[model samples]
Target: MMNKSSQESRVETISEQLSLFALNLKLEQIPISVCAQAKLHMLDAIGIGIASSHYDFAKNILHALMSLQESNDQHYQVLGVPNKLSMRDAILVNGTYIHGLDFDDTHAAGVIHASSSAMAALLSVGQRHNINGQDGLVAYLVAIEVASRIASAANGGFHEKGFHPTGLVGIFGATVLVGRIMKLTAGELTNALGISLSMASGVMEFLEGGAWTKRMHPGWAASSAVTACAMAKNGFIGPRNTFEGRYGLFNSHIDSSNLASLEKCTNGLGQIWEMQNISLKPYPACHYNHAFVDAAVTLRQENAFEIDDIKSIKARISEKQVPVVCEPQASKRIPKNSYEAQFSIHFVIATSLIKGKFTLNELENDTIFDPQILALCQKIEYEIDPKSAFPEFYSGEIEIQLKSGKSLIHREQMNRGSSANPLAKHEVLEKFYSNVERVMSHTAAKKFTEDFLNLEHEKSFINIMNQLKVN
Candidate 1:
C-alpha cells in the first residue's frame, strides 16, 4: 500500500496530468450531444446577461467599468451594452452581470456557476483572437468540462470548508476555455492552471449579510483566468504541479480531495462530455431554495387559496439544508441588498406565493415588500426530512395552512429546468428577447439575438459588437 505522503503526491500528479489532457483535447473530438447542450447553455447565459443588464447592480458594475475602458480591437462586445473592452475586462464585467441576479445555470455535483465563467471567457477571448463560431463553441465546451470536473472532485468539500465553489473552480474553467481559444500548448496550459490557483478566491460571508461581492466573485475569476493565461503565454512560469504539489490546490483548499476522481477528466474524453449535466435555472434565487419556490407555486395553484388565506407556512427539507437556507432568525422580507435576497429562502418563497411567479424584476422591486407577504413570511417554518436528497439534488416539501381549517401541502423532488426537465429552445429565446428588449426595441433585440445565435457563421465579432454601439 502507498504511504500517506506518497498517496498525496500521486494524487497531485494525477490532477496536473488530467488537467493537461483536458486542455490538449480538440473540440472536434467532443461528442455531438455535448456540443448541442453547450450551445443551449451559451444561449441561456447570454439571455440572462442581457436581462440582468437592467438590474441596479449590473448597471452599477457596467458603469464603473466604463470609466476604465481599454483599447477595443476585435474583442467581444459587452452584451446588452454599446461598449467594448479588452478580452479580460470584458469577460470579468460580462460574467459578473450574468450571475449578478443569481439566475444563471448551475451544476448539482460541483456547485460551480458553470456558464457565466465559461461563456464569459469564451466570448471575450474568441472575439479577441477572431476565432470562428465552431471554434468558439468548442472552447466553451472544454471550459465547462474543466469547471464541472473540478467541482465534482471537490464533492461538496468547498461548501463544507466555507468556500464558494463558483469562485474557486470557476477560475480553472475560465483558464481552460481561454487557453483553448488561444490555442495554448499543453505546457503553457499547465502553467496557466498553476498561475490561476494563486488568484482563486470567493467566500460565503456575502451569503450571511447580503453583500455585492457574491456577484463579483465569478467576474474576478474570469478576469484572473484570462490574465493568468496571457501571463503563461508570455513565458511566465508557474508551479507545474499546482494541484498535486506539497501545498497544492486540493490539500490547501479542501479537507481531503480525492485525486482519483481526476481520472474522470480523461475517461471517454471524446465520447462523453460533462457539459450535458449542466442545469438551467428557472428561478432567480439560490439553487438550494428553488425547490421550495417550485413547491410553493404548486401549492398555490392547486389549492386556489387566496393570498389572504395563508395562515401558516412550513417547509420540510433536509437537516443539513436548514442552516444554509431557512435559518428562522434570518431576515427575509425586503433584503438590504441583491445578494441577501438571493440566499433567503423565506423571501423567495413568500414572493412566489404572492406573485405566483418569481422573475428578475420582482426580486429587485421595493414594492415586493407588502405587509401581507411579510406576515406570511413570518409564519413560515422549516422541518428536517432525513431522506431528502439535497446538495446532491435540489428537493423540498412545503406545507401551508389556510384560515379555512384546510392545509395544503406540496412536495418537489427535482427542480424544473434541469437536464431532467429542461426549458425548450423557444423559452430560452423568449427569455433572451425579454431581457434585451429592456434596452433595445423589439427589432433591435431580435436582430441581436439572431446574430448571437448564429455567431459561428459570422465573419467578424465586430459585426455583433457594432450592433450594440450607441449613437
Candidate 2:
C-alpha cells in the first residue's frame, strides 16, 4: 500500500511530469517499433471510424453536431463524409465513429480504448494547423502514452467505481495532445490537464439498455479537451493537484480502499512507452467477451458434436467482468440490439459456437435472433474464475457437456491481440483492410491503406482524411 506521505509527495509532480513529456515529445524521441505500433493502432481506429459512417447512430450524431456548427468559414473534414464541420465538432463525430463499433484498440492494463480519442484529436488539430505528418504522428503517440498510464495506475478501479476509464482518463490525453500540437507552454499544458478533470466523465448506466451514450464517450472527452486547452491558453486557472487533492479525480471517483499510486501516472513516462502495449481488437465487441468467444470457437472447431447434442455449456471469467459482460442474465441472454449483443458474453459465446466464428455480421438483427444461436445461448451459463488474470489478459474458459455424457473444454489464458499474445503486423493490416472495404472501393481502400501505413511522408493529413469519404 502507498503511505500518505509518499502519495502526497508524488501528487504535485504527476501532472507536471505528464505535461512536460507532452510538451517536449518529438518524433525522433520515440522508438521505431513503438512508432510502428502506434501507426498500426491509429490506422485500425481510422478504418473503424470510416465504416461507422454507414451506421444510423453515426448519421444521427452527425446531424446533431451539424446543428451546432458555428460557421462555414472554419471547417474540418469528417471521416467518410463529404460534409465538413467545425474542428471541435469534427473531433466529436470522428471520435464517436472510431469508437462507435467498440472495436478500437485497447490498453489492457488500463482497460481503456486509447487510440480512438487520440486519432480524432490529432487529425482535427493537425489539419487545422496544417502540421506535417511526422509531427502529427508524434502528437498521436503523446496522447495515448499519457492517457494509458493514468488509467493503468487505477488498476481497473474506475470500472469498479462505475466510471468508464476511456472517458474518465481519455480527456487528459486529448488535452495534452492538443496542447502539444498548439505548442502550449509547460504551465499552460499543466493547467489544461487540471481543467480537463471537470470535463472527464462516463458512467456505467449505458449498460442498462444498451444506450448509445457509450459510443459517444471518447468523442465527448476529446471535445471537452479542446475546450479545456483553449481555456488554459487564454489564462484560465485550474487546481494544480487534479488527481491527488481531497476532491480530485481518484479521491472522488474511486473508493479509498481501491486507490492506486498517483506515481503510476508519471513513472517511466518517456522510457517505458506503456501505449506500445495497447491491444487491437479481433472482434467488434466489448473486450471483456473476447476470450470467451475465442474459447467457444476453439471448442466448436475441435468437436464435431451438433448443437442439439449439447446438454449444457458453462463459461468462466474474472469476477470483475461479470457486470460488464455476463449479468444481468436476462439481458445477456437476449440482447435487444447490436450494442447489447456486443457486450453480451452469452450471445457472443453462443454465436461463436453455432457459427464457428463471430464477426461484424453476427451483430446484425437477423443473426441476433438466429434460432440456432438463441438455442445455444439458452444452454450456456457462466461462473466466476477465481484464478482468472483480468485487466491484463482477460482470460476465459468454456466447457460443454454432451447428452452422451461427453465433455469438451477449452481455455484462452491470454486473449488474442493482447501484448503477451500479440497479433502480427499482417493480421492488423488485414483487419484494417476488412473494415475499410465495408465503405471504400477495393482500389480506394488499397491506396488509402498504403498511404496511411507510410503516413510520415505526407505533408498534409487533411488530404489523407479526404480519401475516407464514401462517395
Candidate 3:
C-alpha cells in the first residue's frame, strides 16, 4: 500500500544504504588485522581454485565457454591452464574452480560461502581493469562484509526456503564489489543491485546427494555481477526496493518473519565488519560437519577405539542441518560419489575416526567405497540437538560406544578457523601450498606464495598471474 515516497520515508531502503556504503567506503578505515585477513581469504580462495583446475569438469566447462567467446585475443589467466580468456569467461571459470571442491571459506551466521563469488569477481575484474592490489583488497573486503551481513540477516531463512545462500544472496555482494572496482556512480550501483534480483538464484537440491549445481553457484554469481554492472552502465533501471519491497528478495525468496534481520544487515556496516567472522574451512566438506570432524578425530585419538571395539558412534547436530548434511541418513551413509561424501556427516565422522583426518584425499573416489569407512559409517547415527545455536555457531557433540560397555564423549561449541580462533598465517600458507602444489610447479608455487602474502603492496594482478600454474 505504501508509495515510493512513503516507502523512502518509512526507512532507508536496503538498496540505497548498500549502494552508498559500497561507493564511499574508504580503505584507510579498515583495520590492519582485517586487511591481513582479507589477503588470507583472497589467497586461500585462489589456492583452492588452482587445485580444482585439474578437475575434468573444470577443464571441460572452461573449454566450453572459451569456444563461445567472441575474441580470445583479450584475456585473463585461468589459474592452472595456459589459456587466457575474456573477462566474463575468466570470472565464471575461476569462480567455479574456487568453489568446485567445497573447501572455500564460510560465514556461519549467514550460512554462506562468502569468499568464492566475491573474491573471484574482484580478482577477475581486477585483471581486466589493472586495478591495484590495495583497491582489489578493499573490494574483496567490502564484498565479504556486505555478503556476510546479508547472509547473517537472512539468518537460516534461505535454507528454509530451499535455497543456497551463496547462490541466492551472493550475487548482490559480487555486484557491489564489481561496481566498487568500476567506480560506478551511486545510481549505477543501485541499478546493479536491482538487476541482481532477477539474476540471483541457487537451489539447495544438491543436498539430495551432491550435484554439480552447488559447485557452479559462486561462479554463476560472479558472472551475474559482471552482467549486472554492464546492464547498469547501459542505462538500465531497476526497482529501488529490490530487497524489502512486497515482491522483494526477502519476501519472495525467503519466508523470514524476523524484520530485525534486515536491520542487522546495515546496523554496524563498516563499524563491526562481519567479514572478520568468516571461518576458513579446515575440512574439505560442509561447514555443518566441521566441528564433528574435530570431535571424531579427538575421540578416536583419545580413546583409541578400534573398529571392533566400537559398537556405535552417534553425532548430535542442529536439526536444521539434517536435510543438507545429515539426512536421507541412509544415502549419506552410503554416498554414491566423492562429492556426495563431503556432505555426508556419516562419511565425515567415519572417515575422521578411521584416518584421524579429513582432507581432499578423504573425498577421493577411492575413499568413497572404502569398506572400513562404510562399516564405521553404518554405526554412525545422528540426533538433533535442540540447544544448538546454529546460524551463529555450528557446534557438535560425539559419543562413541565401545564393546567394553564404555562410552567416551566429545563436544565442540565452535569450529576452529573461526575469527575467534583463526588459522594462523603459517597454517593458511601450509594449506595453500598443499592445495596449490598439486597443480603448480615447485618454482611457481614458491613465488606465488611470496606474491600472495605481500599482495596488498602490489599494484597489478599481472604480478600475481605471473606466478600462476599455467603451462
Candidate 4:
C-alpha cells in the first residue's frame, strides 16, 4: 500500500488528469440530452437574475459595480439594467444577482449552486464575443459539468473543511466555461484550472452571521475564472498538475479524498453529462429546509387546521440536518435580513402554515411577523428523525399536536422541484413574471420575456442587451 504522502500524490495526479480530459472535450462529443438540460438551466438562471434585480441590494450592487468600472464600450449587458460593462464585471454582477435571492438551481449530489457561476460567466463572455446560441449552450454545458463533477467528488469535504462548495468548486466550473468560450487549447485550459483553484475561496461563517457575503461567492468565482482564462490567453503558464499536486485541492481540502471518483469526472464525458442532476428550488429557503416546508404545508392542508387551532407544533428532521437550522432563539418575526429568513426553519414553517404558500414577498415583508405568525412559530418544536436523508438530499417529517387533543403528521421524502418532480415550463415562467412584475411595467416584462424565450435564435448580442432597463 502507498504511504500517506504517496497516496496523496496519487489522488492529485488522478484529479489533474480528469480535469485535462474534461477541458479538451468537444460539444458534439457531449450527449444531446445534457446540452438540452444546460439550456433549461441557463433560462432558469437568467430569469432568476432578472427577477432578483428588483431587490434593493441587487440594485445597489449593480449601481456600485457600474460606477467602479465607468466604461460605455458595451462589452456586455447587466441583467435587467440597460447599462453595459466589461465582460468580467457583467458576469460578476449578474452572477451575484442570480444567487442573491438564493433562488438559483442546485445539484443535490454536491450541494452546488451550479448555474450561478457557469451560466453567468458564459452569458457574459458569449455576449461579448457575440457567440451563437449553439456555441453558448455548449460552453454552459462544459462549465456545469466541470463544476458539478468536482463538487460531487469533493462532497461535503469543503463544507466539513469550513468552505462553501458553491464558491470554491464554482471557480473550476467558471474557468472551464470561460476557457471553452475563449477556445483555449487543452494545455491552456489546464493552466486556467490551476489558476482558478488557487483563487478558490468562500467561508461558512456567513451562515452564522446571516451576512450578504454568501451572495458574492458565485460572483467572485466568475471574476476569478475570467481572469484565469484571460491570463492563459496571454501566455501565462500555470501548474499543470494543479488538481493532483502534493498540496492540491482534493488532498488539501477533503479529508478522505477518493481518487477513483476523479475518473467518473471524465468517464463517458461525451455520452453522459452531469448537468441533468440539477434540481430547481420551489421554496426560497436553503435546500435543507425545503422538505420541512413541504411537509408542514401538506400537514396544514390535510388537517384543515386553522392557525388558531394549533396548540403545539413539532418538526422532526435528521440528526445530520439539524445543526444548520432549528434556531429556537430566532426572533418570531419577519427576518431582519433575507439570509436570516432563508436559514430559519421556524420562520419558514410558520409562514408556510399561516399563509398556505411561501412567496418571495412573504419572506421579505415585515408584516409577515404578525402576532398570529409569531404565536404559531413559538408552538413549533423540532426533533431529529432517524430515517431522514439529509446533507445529501433534504427530507423530513413533521408532527403537529393541536389544542383539541388531535394529532397530524406529514412526511416529505424528496425535494419537490427536483428532477424527480420538476417545475413545468409554465411554472418557471410564472416565477419569472412574479419577480419582474415587482419592478417592470407589464408591457416591458412581456416584451422582455418574449425576447428571452427566443434568445437561442438571436444574432446580435446588442438586441438582447438593449431590452434591459435600469428603471
Candidate 5:
C-alpha cells in the first residue's frame, strides 16, 4: 500500500512520464519489426473502415455528422466517402468506421482496439497539419504504446466493472499522439492528458441490447482527445496527478480491490513495445468468442460426425468472458442482429461447427437464424476454465459428446493472430485485400495496397487519405 505522500508522487510520475515519453519518441528509436507490425495493424484498421463505410451504420453516422457540419475543411477525408469534413468530424467518422465491424486489432493484455483511434487521429489531424508519412507513423505508434500500457495495467478490471477500456484509456493515447504531432510542450501535453481524465467514459451496457455505442467508442476517444489537445494548447490548466490521483481513472472506473499495480502502466515504455503484442482479428466478432470458433471448426474437421450425431457440446471459457459472450443464453442461441451474433459465443461456435468456418459471411442475417445453427446452439453449454489464460491470450476449449458413447475435445490455448500463434505476413495482407475488395475494385485495392504498405516513403499524409476517399 502506498502512503498519501508517495501515492501523490506516483500519480504525478505517471502522467509526467507519459507526456515526456510521447514527446521524445523517434521513428529510428523504435525497432524495425515493431514499426512493420504497426503498419500492418494500421492497414487492417483502414481496410475495415473502408468495408464498414458500405454499411448502414456508417451512412447514418456520416449523415448525422454532415447535418451538424459547420467547418468546410477540405483537407480531411472520410474513408469510403467523398465529402470533406472538419478534422474532428472526420476523426470521429474514420474512428467509427475502423471499429464499426469490431474487426480491428486488439492488444490481448489491454483488450483494446488500439489502431482504430490511432489511425483515425493520424490520418485526420496528421493530414490537416501536413505531417509527413514518417512523422505520422511515429505518432500512430506513440498512441499504441500509451493506450496498451494504460489499459493492460487495469488487468481486465475495467471490463469486469462494466467500463469499456478502449474509450477510457484510448483517449490518453490519442491525446499523446495529437499532442506529439502538434509539438506541444511537456506541460501542455500533461494538461491534455489531465483533461482526458474528465472526458474518458465508455460502458459495457451496449452488450445487453447489441447497441451501436460500442462501435463508436474508439472514434469518440480519438475525437475527444483532439478536443483535449486543442484546449490544452491554449493554456487550459488540468490536474497534474490524473492517473494516480485520489479520484483518478482506475479509482473512479474500477473497484479498489481489483486494481493492478499502477507502476505497470509506465514501466519499460520504449523498450518493451506493447504494440507488437496486438493481435489482428481473424473473425469479425468479439475477440472472446474467437478461440471457441476456432475450436469448433477444428473439432468438426478432425472428427467425422453428423451435426445430428452430437449429444451435447460444452465450452470452457474464462469466467470473465461469461457475461460478455456466454450468458443471456436465449439471446446467444438466436441472435437478433449482426452485432449480437458477433458477440454471441453460442452463435459463433454453433455456426462454426455446422458450416466449418466463421467469417464476415457468418454475421449475415440468414446465418444468424440458420435452422441448423440454431438447433446446435441449444445443445451448447459452458463452464469456467480453471486454467484460463484470459487477459494474456483469449483461450478456449470445446468438448463434444457423441450419441455413440465417445467424447472429443480440442483446446486453443492461444488464439490465432496473436504473437505466439501469429498469422504469416502474407496472411495479414490477404485479410486486408479481402476487406478492401468489398468497397474497391481489385485494381484499386492493388494500387492502394502498394502505396499504403509504402507509407513511410511518402512525403505527405494527404496522398494516403486521397487513396481512401470515394466520390
Candidate 6:
C-alpha cells in the first residue's frame, strides 16, 4: 500500500501533469472536430449570456456587482450592455449572465457546467488582452479538460456532498485559462490551481429556496480564478497537494471520495480529449429536463391528444436526476417561481406538451402556471430508471395514458444537442438570432451574427465586443 506521503505526491504529480498540458498544448494540435465543437459551444454561450442579461435577477446582479468595482475606464464589455467596466468586474458580471439561465453547455459525464466558467473567463480576459480566436479556443479546451477530469474523478461525490461542481470544480479550469492567457510557466500554473483551492466554493443550497446563488456559481468561480492566477503570478505560495491533501477537494468537498478514479485524472492527458463530451442545451430548463423536453415535444407533435383526452403523463429517468429535478414532486408540479419552474421536470414537460416547445418564454408566470399546464402538471409523475447510464448519457421516456384508454410512449436516450445528436448550424443560428434580437435591432443582430461567425478573421477582440453590444 502507498504511504500517506506517497499518496499526496501522486495527487500533486497529476495536478502538475494537468498544468503541463495547459502550458504546452498548441492550437494546431486540437482536432478539427474538437475545434468546430468548441466554436459552437462558444457561440452558444455568448447567445445564452446575452439572453440571460435581460432577466431581472441578472440585471440586479450586474448592477449590484458593478457598484463594488472602483470606477475606471479600463473598458471591458458586459454582454448586451453598452457600458464597460474594469476587467475583473466584467468577468464576474458576464460570467454570471452566461449561467443565469442554466442554459450553458455541460459535460454530462462530470455533471459540470464547464463552459459557463471557462467561456466567461476566456471572453473577458481574451478581449482585454486581444487574444486571437484560435488561442482563445485552445485556452478554453485546456481549462475545461482539466476541470472535467477532476470532476469525473470525483464520480458525482461533490453533488452528493452539496457542492455545485460547476463552482467548486470550475474554478480550477478558469484558473488554468487565465494562466494560459498570462503565459504562466508550468510551475506557476500549478500554483494557480493550488491557490484557487482556497477560493473555490459553491453549495447546492440554492435548490432549497429557488435562490439566485446557483446562478452566481460559475461567474463567481471564474472571477475568483482570475484573482487566484493574478496572485500566483506574484509568486504566491499555496499547498502543493491541493487535490489529495487530507483536507483537499476530494476529502473535503466530496462525500466518500472515489480515490481510485481520482487517481486516474491524468491517465489520457493529451490523447482522449474531454472537450468532445460537452453538451449544449436546446431548452432553458435544467439539463436534467432535456430528454423529457424532447419526449414531451414529440408527444405533442406525433399525437393529436387534446387537454380533455389526456389522463396522465409519467416520465422515467435516471435515478440520479431525482434530487435535482423530480423530487419535491408537489413543489415541482406547482413551482413557486420562474426559477423554480426552470428546474421542475414536471413543469417543463407539461409546458412542452401544451405549447409544443419549451423556450425561455415558457417559464413566465402566465405560461408556467397556465391552467392547462398546471392541470397537466398535476397529472404528471416520475419513476426512477435503475438501469440509467447517468453521468454518461442523460436519457428519458414519457408515457401518456389517454382518457380513451389509448397509450402513447416516447423514449429518448440522446438529447437534442449532444454531439451524437446535434442541432443544425441554422438551428443554432436561429437560437442566436432570437437571443440577440431581444436586445439589438433586427439588422444589427444579423450583422453581428455574421461578424461573430467570422470572428477569427478579425484582428482585435474590441471589434467582437463592439458588435456584441446594441448598435
**Largest lDDT belongs to which candidate?**
5
Model 3 RMSD vs true structure: 3.0
Question: Count of backbone clashes for each model?
Answer: 2, 0, 1, 3, 0, 0
Error of 2 at 303 (Å): 1.1
Residues 61-128, candidate 5, lDDT per residue (tens digit)? 99998998875564588887687788888899999999999998999988998889888888888888
In order of appearance, the predictions have TM-scores of: 0.89, 0.95, 0.95, 0.88, 0.96, 0.94
The residue-by-residue lDDT of candidate 6 on 1-471, one tens digit each, is 998666434534566778878888987787877777777778888888889878898789878866777766547888887756778778888888899988888888888998989988988898878887767778888988998898888887887778899999899999989998998877777888889999998999888758999888888899898898888889997776778878877888766644427654676878888888878888888888899889988888888879779998889998878999987888888888888898898998888888888888887889966888888899999998765667677888999999999999999888777767877888887887787777887788778777666655667766677677654
lDDT of each residue in 1-471, candidate 4, tens digit only: 778666433424433554455555666676666665565567678778877776787888878877887566656777776667777778888888888888888988778897998877877777777777666766777777777777877646677677788898899888877887787766677788887778988887776667888888998899899999899888888876665567777777777643425554555555566666788887777887888788878887777767778888777877655656665345423356668778777778888887778768776656355677767777777887887766456787778888899998888877777766677777776776666665577788678776666555766655665566564
Model 5 C-alpha lDDT versus the unseen true structure:
0.88
Candidate 2, residue 133: Cα displacement in angstroms equals: 1.1
The TM-score obtained by model 2 is 0.95
Q: Tens-digit lDDT track for model 3 on 1-471?
A: 888666444436788888888888888988988888888888899989988998877988888887887874546778767887887778888888999998999998888997999977877788778887878888888888888888777768888879899988899899999999888977788899999999999998987756788888898899899999899988999888888889888888776564426786787888898878889988788889999999988987887657789999889998888888887988999999878898899999999888899988888877889999998899999998876767677888998999999999999887888876678888888888888886776677777778777777888976666667366
| Model 6 misplaced stretches (Cα beyond 4 Å) | 1-12, 257-260, 454-457
Go through the candidates in order and give each one's C-alpha lDDT: 0.74, 0.86, 0.84, 0.74, 0.88, 0.83
Q: Please give the TM-score that candidate 1 achieves against the real structure.
A: 0.89
Candidate scoring better on TM-score of 5 and 6: 5
Question: Model 4 compared with the native: what TM-score?
Answer: 0.88
Task: Single out the weakest 10-residue window by summed lDDT for candidate 5.
Answer: 4-13
RMSD of each: 4.5, 4.0, 3.0, 4.9, 3.6, 3.6
lDDT (Cα, tens digit) per residue for candidate 1, span 1-471 = 888656434424543555565556765676666666677678778777777766677778877877787555424577777766666677888888888878888987787797888877776776667777777776777778777877777657677677887888899888888877777767677888899989989887776677788787888898899889889999999887676567766777777643425455445555666676677887888888888888878877877768788788887787756656766444654465556666777777888888788877666547355666666677787788765766557878888888998988888777776667677878877776776676678888777777777655767655555676643
Worst 10 residues of 1 by lDDT: 7-16
The collision pairs in model 5 are: none
The superposed Cα distance between candidate 6 and the true structure at residue 344, in angstroms, equals: 0.8
